[model samples]
Target chain A: MGAGHAHTLHHVGDSPVHRLPAHVKIVAAFLMVIAVVATPREAFWVFGAHLALLVGIWVTARIPVAAIAARSLIEAPFVALAVLLPFFATGPRTEFLGLSLSVDGLLAGWNILVKGTLGVLISVTLGMTTPVRDLLAGLARLRVPGMVTTIATLMVRYLEVIAAEARRMRLARVARGHDPRFLWQIGPTVRGVGTLFLRSYERGERVHLAMLARGYTGSMPLLGVPTTGRRTWAVALAPAAAAVLFATAGYA
Target chain B: MTPSLEVEGLAFAYPDGHQALFGVDLRIEQGERVALLGPNGAGKTTLVLHLNGVHRAGAGTVRVGGLEVAKPHLQEIRRRVGVVFQDPDDQLFMPTVGDDVAFGPANFGVTEPELSLRVKQALGAVGMGEHADRSPMHLSGGQRRRVALATVLACDPEILVLDEPSSNLDPVARRELAEVLLGLDRTMLMVTHDLPYALQLCPRSVVIDEGVVVADGPTRDLLADPAFLAAHRLELPFGFSV
Candidate 1:
């Protein structure tokens, strides 16, 4: 529930990015990612342009540089896999800074880093501006499976409750003089996780019944009377469209 | 007009061989606000669950609005019976208040325009219209409870079944909830340990102890009877004899 927690990633703002329709943003993000992935690794200039375009968009959206850096750092571990490729990969050997590296490995690493960074940036930007509900609404609008959207919606809604339950359970255990610190004490933590899972499962059943009582048959309805104006779509697509054209010019 | 609800010889037992309800029988008239008072493990919830076909009756029948609560009428029964669970967290499962409110109507196939109107009107009824876009978790306990009620109200049910509706509310919120309940025109079956809330919101009362109806009468008269309330583990607040 703390503001800096992963679940609380959304930043309240009045930027155009914040006002963009979720469905449009979702589609645009997907298209941008596909375009990035399809771009060859040798297109170094295109990658540079892509990064520049993203940076420009981020700046125009008024997202804080510190926030972006923190999120990128959080995502750094996944990108670290790509970083390792340059050293471990087998190809024509090259020496740099007293270390051996491979030509193919360098290209592989560059490809992953650029593609992964772009993908993560798109997702992080989406998460930071749009509330979780809007994301689900957007997914629903984009014809993602209803069940998938419903499950994601339910999961996000109950995540806090589940986390709170875990916290309460931990406190209760600690009050009973259970100190789970060392490897040997991991038993209690495992048992706690198991208990949490069971509690969550039971809660799901109860929630289903509650839904039934409220006349829930299956599909969840769209949130808010969607006032999807042309301006909203136009604004959302501008950055993605610009990025695509910029990346395309690199193809020429 | 037919009664809002009728249960005859309704019995249930868990798979572990523990019988919860032992041939319980009850009748609720149309537009009647009745409180179902019982101690813990007295099958109060088990009985209410039967009204909407959540819990199947083991040995008898549950009828809502003249339709038998069977598989064929399950959806219809649910549409007409709005159940507000004790835990608002469990009730409001959707991410936003608006989605949660619209859930019931959406399932029942209310058109888009009608659905929006119902969601708005329902939230308005609970005085939570401004919070439609807000996440349910972000709301206070009272607000969540109001949204939970709105979720049910959106379905436009004829019989509102609320379990411990005022359990966790502060005094002001509890009073706000009481006023909201009072304003609703539908027949309500409220299950609660709070005798005062029952007395305030319901005209009639039914006592369930050990899976059976032990007493049924006017709320005031029943609460006034010391022996009757004590028999079912109910007590008026200190110095507030009924």
Candidate 2:
């Protein structure tokens, strides 16, 4: 059940968290993120508890902490924005390291940094535990429009195919002595991307045709797990339930 | 019983005024394995599309299992006629192998028990029962082809049309696919450029050129005529014989 193509971040294992149905995990993750966002930013301990919750899941799911840390670097650009907030944000100023910084700006920066990190962490944990197909299924079960899940499913399926085509096109250009290292040689690269887009569009057409040939009249059939039971939901949502408790305590 | 596939006076032209097929007439009885030999733009795919209603017939008629290939019978026709496209990647678009195989049946409104049974039976037919949990992306070209065939088979189609099935396969994969195809006792129309594959798998061969069926004869007799093959722009591999 773990074959989600090679591009997914799913850590294939037999952990209880992994065993839980995808929709339940999706709900749990959603609730966890909502709790994180709802908690007051000043409740720094609640944020710590959120991180601890994620760390526990990672440990149980057998995902490497180093890998999650590395993946979380995708938010580094946001960190840059957060770093600048203290300098330009208009609020009461405090002196730190001989430089005047806004106290509210510091708090705002922490809000973005912490919330964004926790959000991304929650997503990574979900991604690592649930296969891509299951994630889409979870979304489907949550009544998130079928059209969105269908698009997501196809994206997961064809991501590598299109990437491989791009690689092949690059190789063909390189074989023809097109040097991409120079600034002036960007024309063909841009055109190649354009060509790749067209090719992908045409591929989409062919895939639709193939789907139709198999009697796909209009909507895609619900191909996900038929039912995710109440027991599974209660079992899976425990972490989010813990986060909710932490959030209420934080409010208190 | 009616012929498995019957296309009479079939014709098609693209929206750009490009004439792809012109009044093509063909019929294949039940259980016949016919190889469609054609050049790059000889309307083989266009004809196949007409078989399953992907392309509405521009001129004439197409019937599958005695049912007209029109709006009324499209759903049923698609169930009866399965086209395994040349590219397996284009065919198997689901996240997992089982899901891809199940896609067609589920679309056909086949519910559980029957749906899962078809998936298992189809995968078993292609000798890929073990890899149902794997991603089609991770499979070898041949394995992917087999799974693609399974996706079609899971629909319980009466006729299978394959487009360039042997393309991009190593010799071993090619032969293995041939074995699988040989074991399936259903009507098949294989569109291919491989003369040797035609000679090996199909007893009868149909040659289409310039939007028409130019020749329809025994595979051995057709491949034996070098001049005829050369005239159709089909060249047998050197030193290969029927």
Question: Best candidate per DockQ, number?
Answer: 2
Stretches > 4 Å off in candidate 2: A1-8, A59-62
Model 1: per-residue lDDT, tens digit, B97-189?
887888888878787888899999999999999998777878999999999999989889879999999988999999999998899888999
For model 2, report DockQ. Answer: 0.77
lDDT of 1 by residue, A1-252 (tens): 225433667766778777788888888788778778878778887777777877876776798978877776766876888889988999798999998999899899888888898888888888777777778888998889989998998888888899989999999999999997789988988999999999999999999888778666777766554777887777777777877876677678
Q: What does the lDDT read for residue B218 in candidate 2?
A: 96
Cα lDDT, all candidates: 0.85, 0.90
**Candidate 2's error at B78, in angstroms?**
0.8
For candidate 2, the TM-score is: 0.94
At residue B7, candidate 2 shows an lDDT of 88
Q: What's the TM-score of chain B for every model shown?
A: 0.98, 0.98
For this target, which candidate reaches the highest lDDT against the unseen true structure?
2
Candidate 1 chain A lDDT trough over 10 residues, lowest sum: A1-10
